[model samples]
Target: MTIRFRPSEPTDAAALLRVWRRAVDGTHHFLSAQDRVAIDPLVADYVGSTALRIAEKDGEVVAFMGVTGQNVDSLFIDPAAHGSGIGRSLVDEVARPTTVEVNEQNEGAVAFYKRLGFEVTSRSETDEDGRPYPLLHMRRD
Candidate 1:
């Protein structure tokens, strides 16, 4: 697949949100139904507000990531695009973040970050939104 990377535009919000939803559904089975419902609008808002790096394949958005300085705020790849290295490329080439947070229950995510040279530095009992899902704070070292 030929993947292109570019800065997100205002028109990309809907596609990015679609990628986010599909990715989360594919990987985040641990989330409670209620929590998922509550988080959807928040994610939609975040998609519109954050500046993102988008990965497009054949002119279709397949993944996107958000970064601020040395921190990776978000990364999501469409479920159909999983295992394609798109997420890895986004993290390594686009975000290149020194710090990231992963849901502790998402073992695949934790392992993915570890493979990218991140080590867990701490843990939190709740997510950034104070939800019950735990988070693993990681830093590249």
Candidate 2:
């Protein structure tokens, strides 16, 4: 399938949120149900307000990444589209972050970032929202 990359438009927020929910549900197994519920609104607000790079396949948004300066703040792909190199393409062509953070429990994500040249620099006992899940700070530079 051909993938198209572009900057996200205001109208893309809903699609991005759908991708986020699917991605998180598929990969974020360590999240508590309560935490997941609590974080949904936060994710919605962020998706609507942040600038993201989107990957579309067959005219459907299948992935998105948020980058700021040299940091990658978020990357989520539709669960149905995993293992398709969409995430890799987003990092290579759009995000290009020197730094990224991933949930420590998300082994797949850690491996994916490592394959892209990121190395763990530090760790946090809790996520940014003060959730119990730990986070690994990674950098490529």
Candidate 3:
């Protein structure tokens, strides 16, 4: 299991979207099946604060991560590739004092970030979406 990290390119957008939507669906457990669909592949580029990165194994993307300024826009791995250390690689490679807004409902990610030595300084809502997401702010130690 040799995982490789690369700066993401425009060509890898589709693969990144696949991983992102899966993570979104996992977050939106309450949404109806029909509403679970992602809006569009173009939405990611428009998300305003995303700087994309791709993780490949055997020359295929297995994970996607985006860093916007100091915030982690998202970190996603194929379900089959979970626990493969891809996420940790992303964090360590881009290592900086960072902040991320996790769906308050996604306890697993919250705990994982904490284990990595991130302390939540506050919680807040998502921008105008009224989704009540928590803004977890952390300074990497």
- Which segments of candidate 2 are over 4 A away from where they belong? 94-97
lDDT (10s digit) by residue, model 3, range 43-105: 566332355778898887888877867777778777667677888888876557777666555
Worst 10 residues of 3 by lDDT: 40-49
- What are the clashing pairs of model 1? none
Candidate 2 local lDDT, 1-141, one digit each (tens):
788999999899899999999999999999999999999999899989988999999899999999988888899999899889999988876344489999999998999999999999999999997989999999886
Give the count of colliding residue pairs in each prediction: 0, 0, 0
Q: Give the top-scoring candidate (lDDT).
A: 2
Clashes counted in candidate 1 amount to 0
TM-score against native, each model: 0.94, 0.95, 0.79
Model 1 stretches with alpha carbons more than 4 Å out: 94-97
Would you list the rank order by TM-score, best first? 2, 1, 3
Worst 10 residues of 2 by lDDT: 89-98
At residue 131, give the lDDT of candidate 3: 41
lDDT-superior candidate, 2 or 3: 2
lDDT of 3 at 26: 61
TM-score of 1: 0.94
Supply the global lDDT for candidate 1. Answer: 0.89
